[model samples]
Target chain A: MIIRMAFTEFKLYLREPASVAATLGLPLLIVVSFGLLINPGTDTSSLVTYFPGMAIAFSLAILSLNLLPTILANYREKGILRRLSTTPVPPASLLLAQVAVSFAVALAMTLIVVVVGHFVIGFTVPAQLGGFLLAFVLGTLSLFTVGLVIAAIAPSGRAATGIGMLVFFLNMFAGGVFTPRETLPDFLNRIGDFLPLGATLTAMRDAWSGSFPQPLHLLVMATITVVFGLAAAGLFRWE
Target chain B: MAIIEVTNLHKRYRDHVAVHDVSLTVQRGEIFGILGPNGAGKTTTVECVEGLRAPDGGTVRVLGKDPRADRTHLRTKIGVQLQESQLPDRLRVGEALQLYSTFYPDPADWRRLLSDWGLEAKRDTPFGKLSGGQKQRLFIALALIGNPEIAVLDELTTGLDPQARRDTWQLVEEIRERGVTVLLVTHFMAEAERLCDRIAVIDAGRVVAVDTPSGLVSRVDAEQTVRFRPSAPLAEHLLTDLPEVSSVRRVGGQLVVSGTGNLLHAVTSVLARHQVVAADLRVEQADLDDAFVALTGRKLEESK
Candidate 1:
């Protein structure tokens, strides 16, 4: 039943062209557009790590910060969750289905970016495969949990979208998506290291450059995941 | 047998009471109505029965189980169509039905429900694109998809046109024909009169009366009025002398006679004896609307 619910949710997600464009099309567009300009072969600088990191970060950010909150809050606002509670199946199944769908989308986008970047853009796969996978999993969980918190508190769909956009931009700036962390000031980089998106990008970059991620970055992501996951579960309202 | 029994149910919010001292019972295989104007606690009462809200006081039992305590088990037996609830805009009709059918252990076939509710052509249509009548039909279809023994529909036709409302009423009747007990909540007098076997008239968070449509009207007053334009001038004493006639008056070439207990028969007999032709005759009796006014001291629409 949960699998069926998730499958239906995925189908509904596909029907929304705007969501598909943002989550899937936008990230691929960013990778291709930036890859053409920066030739990873000749640019031996740390700049090669910037493009793929930004693409993956953007995809995860859109899925977690924007889509997740907006859709879940909309379900509450429209009484879909209330309607589901009347059925024999619990409404939490819908919530789990939503999370599963979001996770699947994030995973699919990550793979697409990695493969397309490596083969088409002349970029290298992360040499430290274990570190890369760890960073990716922790980052996705942390960011998605933050989105769940937003969904739990937001009163309406429009408000959720607004709050999500604000958070997304803040994460983008702090995570070094707008400008490479290498170019940022030392003080700004210190702050960025603690943010979910920033920690993810820095860790992914380190793995891509044949080094394991810093333990501090991994710890920060894990802490955020636990704290925000608990908050979301505690505050969520079925109505 | 009584499938649902709500006794002395009391529920209140922080600042105000939504339902106060309400009680009613719904028998199996009958359409029981909870009729009231807006803010009359009609929805609150039904919500308690559905186990959507926990009553602050009183006991509610459905199919011999406490609604709140046995919610998971009761959910399979009670299908609900909540007021102001909606589906995702992009969810197709067929997909919505198919998805909900999986929620129950024994569900009605989605394909047959599609045809039963006249939604086969709209199976692929998204919820946002359907018309209001079609959307209501879809909601009813979803409610029955679980094959529940009791179906609760709240404000089923509040915003529908007259023709659409009538069509939906027919569909509700068909539901009863399937041996499913129905609990209908509405503020429309005609709707309750036409569909409900018995109605509990709720007012100001309390039940004012509970009886069949005709029974409620009789409770108000059995006054009947017969109006007609006489073909020839008739003597006023002719109707005044009859015991059934309470009063008689003439207004603009028409005789207005108000009385009780077979007043129409008494008046017609008198007219026939006097050889006075009564043209354009009309009879008016107390209806549910009048009963509502008498019971609550306010018209249903006025309270709205």
Candidate 2:
């Protein structure tokens, strides 16, 4: 049932150019802008070095904070969820559809960013494929779960948009999208490791730089994903 | 067996009681009308029966299954059309029918439904782009897609013009002709009179009266009014001496005389005696509207 709903949702999602632009186009724009701004002449190739972190933040922001809310908002505004409530469709199928679509979008966005950053912008791929894949899967789960929570609670599309923007911006900054956490203030650095966004970003960066993070970072992200996922399922409203 | 049996159903929102101990039975192959104004709990009660809402108290059985407890089974057998429910803006007319049809084991033929609803040209058009009447027709088509034993339609023709409204009414009759029970919710007395085999008149979340449309109309003892456009304005003195005349009032260059049986004959005789040759004389018989007004003590619009 989830697969069937996801297939239909994916088709519906493709028909909306605006959604495609937000999910795919925005991330590409961010990658290009950052790549140009960070002069290659710099000692560490500043922008290229940040590609892995950028990928994590972009996918998380787009999938969890942007795509999830918009879809859920549309469902509420159109009364699609309310109508579905009267059908034999299991209520959980809605949440599964949301997570599946977001996961697919995130995976696609990751591949696009990787291909463009490496082939077009002359960035290098992570040395360890196994580590990168592990980090990517964990980061995807973390973003997907948070997105589910936001969609579960938002009252309307407009409200969801507003809330999604706020969370996405905050996460982008705190999750080490532009600058590494080692450069942040001491107090923020202390709590940052525990933040879902921060933990996922740190893990992704380590995988990209070819150095693995402490296993605890991956565990923290996984635990948060599980807890938040359950909460979202419980709080979800068809209407 | 009755498709739906709603007994002592009550739903309250905050401190306001939206549905107050309302009860009704919709039998097989019958069109049952729930007539009430906005916020009169017509939508709420129907929603409860469709398993879209859970009533605060009392039991609702749709096809002998509890709506809230056995919702999955009940939903497969019942179809619901809320006034405000809509599909995604991107969904096409044909896609909407196909998607809904998948929910039931035995769905009606999709092509026939589209042609019957005059939606063949609009099949590829997005749902958001359809006109008001077109959208309404698509909704009715979707509701019947499952070949449901019972279909619930809320405010079936609230926004259509007279012609479109009549078209929808004809379609509804066709559904009944196919042996499907229909639960129609509306505020329009004319619609109830025209379509319902029996109607339950609801006011302020409770069933105030239930009967055949004419049976309810007869409850008020409403007079059959005779209206005429006099060559000259009717004099108030002409109606003063007639005992059979209940009330006489001049409204907009015409005289409206309201009275009991044989009032038209008596009115004509009185007018002729007074040398009145009215240009346009029309009888305004008591209708379901009169019954609604009498039972509720308020017009539908006023209550809303």
Q: Which candidate is the best by DockQ?
A: 1
- TM-score of chain A for the candidates in order shown: 0.98, 0.86
| Inter-residue clash pairs, candidate 2 | none
Q: State the lDDT of candidate 2 residue by residue for A1-239, as single tens digits.
A: 45657777788889988878877887788777766666433436333556546754666677778778777876877788877777777656776786787788778887888788767665566655677777778877876777777887888878777888887777777777656776778777556677677777777767766777658778878887899889877987777
Candidate 1: misplaced stretches above 4 Å? none
What tens-digit string does per-residue lDDT give for candidate 2 at B1-304?
Answer: 7778999999998999999989998889999999998888999999899887789999998888898889877777887787888888888898788777776678888788999889999999998899878988998888888778888899989879999899889989988998889999998878899999999999988999999998998898877788888875567767745766888887888888888878888877877887878778999887887788899898876777
lDDT (Cα, 0-100) at B275 in candidate 2: 84
On a 0 to 1 TM-score scale, where does candidate 1 land against the true structure? 0.98
TM-score (0 to 1) of chain B, per candidate? 0.98, 0.86
RMSD per model, one decimal: 1.1, 3.5
User: Would you give the TM-score of chain B in model 1?
Assistant: 0.98
